[model samples]
Target: MKPAELRNLGIGAVLVALAAIFPLVNDGYWLSIATTAMMYIALSTSWSLFSGPTHLIALSTAAFFGIGGYLVGTGMSDYDTSFWSMAILAPLVATAVALLIGLATLRLSGVYFVIFTLGLAEMIRNLVSWVQNNFLGSRGLYVLTDFTEAHIYWMLLGVSVVVFLFGWWINRSRLGFALKIIGNDEEVARHVGINTAWSKVILFMSTGFFAALIGAIVAPRYSYIEPNVVFSPQLSFLVVIMALLGGTHRLWGPLVGVIPFTLAWEAISVSFPNSTTLFLGLSFLIIVYVLPDGFTGLLEKFTRRAAK
Candidate 1:
């Protein structure tokens, strides 16, 4: 590896080590906040792994995430299945769904793709709600578990670490190069012999898998799972905003955006619960207008200027 790559790896290791100490040293509100941050870190990072290179703004995160949560909820509540089994099955189910969705929708690009993905979560939520009401005669499931907040935090943190490592590997691999080419120009990528469709589908599946796994791991925290709550469209928007704010061009960029945005969002949710959506809208606008490339992009510019 180059010197810069080695330095980045060292920095990542240090940051992960520091994050691992949060649950050990804290509890209650702060630990919960850290856990939420970890969740976004994983979500946004995995999100960028696909969206960053493809430049396809997908808003189907909540769809896959809800699938995982609902699976775990149904398994534990209805089938008396173990948490581990549900968790394992969640990602597989999500991957399969992503394959179907990607095959159907990856051909579309720009705003058409964005609109379709945004609608996907709502469609899935309504479908799940209908099934529950008609067949099960229930609207929600209770996820009772012995796992504590700390356990959730650790699991989220572990997922974040894995995502970052995997992203790093992808960024250095040929697939990543192909993705960049696709993002630059699909026609050019095709001319160069890149299998654009499968490349995109593969990355999209990865995002779905991680999102679902995280959803499964965090299901017990809700205790009561409903389609609307688990499949909130807000989750999709938040992931997009967080990834964009971090500047998805670099693997570690989402972490930069997730930390501060998550903290500020927590405050906003508590202090102004009624206007959280308004604030979310405003935040997205600000990020787009002021920091289109995100904090990482700004930092890169500053670094280059300083070097000169």
Candidate 2:
């Protein structure tokens, strides 16, 4: 590995080590806040892994996430299956769904792709609700488990670590090079012999897998999961905003964005619960108008000036 990569890895390790100490030192509301932050950290990072390189603006995260939550909910509540078993199966199911979606939709680009992805969660949510109401005789399922907030936090942190490492590896691999080329120009990438569609599908599947895994991990926290709650469209927008706010160019950028944003969001949810949607919209506007390149981009500018 290059010196820069090694340095990044070392910094990431230290940050993870410090984060691990949070639960040990604090079990109050802050611990819960930290856990939520870690969840977004994982989600935004995983989202960036594909969207950053491909510039696809996928809005289907909630679909995969809800799938995982519903799987765990149904497995534990209806089938009497173990939480771990559901957790294990969730990603596989999500990956399969992603493959199907990717194959069908990856060819579309620009606003059309974005529109399809945005609609996917709503479509899936309505379908799930219908299935539950008509066939299952319920609007939701219970996911009772002994896992506490701390356990969930740790699990999310572990997933975040793995994702970061995986992203780091991808950044240095031939696949990453292909993605960069594709992002630059898909036509050029095709002309140059890159299988752009397959490359995108692979990354899309990865994002789906991680999102599902995370949803499964957090299912117990919800306890009673309804399709509407699990498949909330707000979650998708939040992940996209967080990833973009941090600057998706770097593997660690999303983490930088997630921490501050999560804390602010928590405060907003507590202080002005009814106005969150308004605030979320405002935040996106600010990100687009003022910090289009994100905090990482701003930092790079400062670094360049200092160097000069």
Candidate 3:
């Protein structure tokens, strides 16, 4: 493996090792935080699949994410489906939604793409709210399942690791190189005969797969699914923050992003509460202007400079 790839693997190994004892080392406080952090990490990695690889800043990430949770909760409880079985169903459902979304919005570009995605997410949220109110008899439908926290926790961690590796694998593939080109210059990519339209489809669908998967597994963890929470812009912000903080369009960008960013959210929410958005926005602005490589990029640059 190249140094970057090896570094990624090494970090994954350390995280896995730490998670092995996370449940044992303390009370629910640490484990719960770790679990939450890891979920965001997984979600962030999912968004990176499209945004980093294929040059799409999809704001409709929460649509499929919430859909995942609804699939598991509604399916397992209302339809009498199994947990593991629904996990499989969740991604497929999300993929279908993503394909439809891609077809609808693929022709849109830049800020227009972002706006269309947001519109789609809002539409889904409102539609789900109606279903919850009229069809599901309100209270957002509680999912009765036997899956334990540890079961879900371990599964999330495994998936987070897998998602991280998935991003790295994309970095190494010809498709990934193609994505880089498209992201850099769609004109050049088009000149080279790259299928920009289809790539965006693949990109968005892949993102939906994981985002929906995380949303699905986590919904059961809550045992209740709400339309607003499921299709939250906060979730979108968290994913974007992870990618930006880590360094966008790179393998480890989102990986570098989740740790400090998650901790910051937890800490500030406890203290400042309402002002957290302001703080987050300021940090993001600074990062974009001053440290475009993200925190990880900065470290790598310093390491190189120090070596010289």
Weakest lDDT window of 10 consecutive positions for candidate 1: 107-116
What lDDT does the true structure give each of the candidates?
Answer: 0.91, 0.91, 0.78
Query: Model 2 off-target regions past 4 Å?
Result: none
How do these models rank on TM-score, best leading? 2, 1, 3
lDDT (Cα, tens digit) per residue for candidate 3, span 75-169: 77677778778889999999998898788778567666777876776788888778767887746467767766766777788888788777777
Candidate 2, residues 1-308, lDDT tens digits: the string is 78976887788789889998899899889998898899899999999999998988989899999999999999988889999999999999999999998888887666666888888889998998888888888555898888888999999999999998889889889999999999999999999999998999999999999999999999988999988888999999999999999999988888889988998899999999999999899989999999988999999999999999
Q: How high is each candidate's TM-score?
A: 0.97, 0.97, 0.90
Model 1: per-residue Cα lDDT over 74-93, one tens digit each: 98887899999999999999
* TM-score, predicted candidate 3 vs. hidden true structure: 0.90
C-alpha lDDT of residue 163 in model 3: 83
Q: Is candidate 2 or candidate 3 better by lDDT?
A: 2
How many angstroms is residue 244 displaced in model 3 relative to the true structure, after the best TM-score fit?
Answer: 0.5
Superposed model 3: Cα runs more than 4 Å off: 1-11, 136-140
